[model samples]
Target: MPALFPLLRGRVLCSGALGGRKPDARVYARALAQLGARAAHTLFVDDLFVNVRGARAAGLEADTVRDARGLRRVLKRYGLA
Candidate 1:
């Protein structure tokens, strides 16, 4: 994963890499705040409903995706792609 950082750079967060034992949107929200982003304004994308639910619970907009194509559509909906 360390070697892949360059390709995956820019505002990406991973709980396992960050030592989180479980998915927690509050932790993600705090990280976003530290990075100068508002939780309400950020979009959290996850393939798992549990993760998505956690993100929404923490005040972030959330989306579920099964693939990159699905993700593109979601982004387009938000004018992000």
Candidate 2:
């Protein structure tokens, strides 16, 4: 796993499970912070409100999307499209 850390940078890190038993956003947020990123500068997108709320609680801006169209809309709103 240590060998894969470097390769994971700049990638979208997500929990493998669809719902239960997944690592929460707080964990990833803290890891990113330790990697020298400010939570406020990070944007977390998830389909679930619980996950979105979790990310927000971790100090990151978060959005909940219902589908790919919603995701595109968010990206456009952020000028990331």
Give TM per candidate.
0.76, 0.66
Q: For residues 1-81, could you state the per-residue lDDT of candidate 2 as single tens digits?
A: 345357557555545422323237557555565567788777778788887788788787779998878977886787666
lDDT of each: 0.75, 0.67
Reference-based TM-score, model 1: 0.76
Q: Write the per-residue lDDT of candidate 1 for residues 1-81, one digit (tens) a residue.
A: 255357446678667665463357557756676568888888888899888888888888889998978887888898776
Best by TM-score: 1
lDDT of 1: 0.75
Residue 71 CA displacement from its true place in model 1, Å: 0.5
The prediction achieving the highest lDDT against the true structure is 1
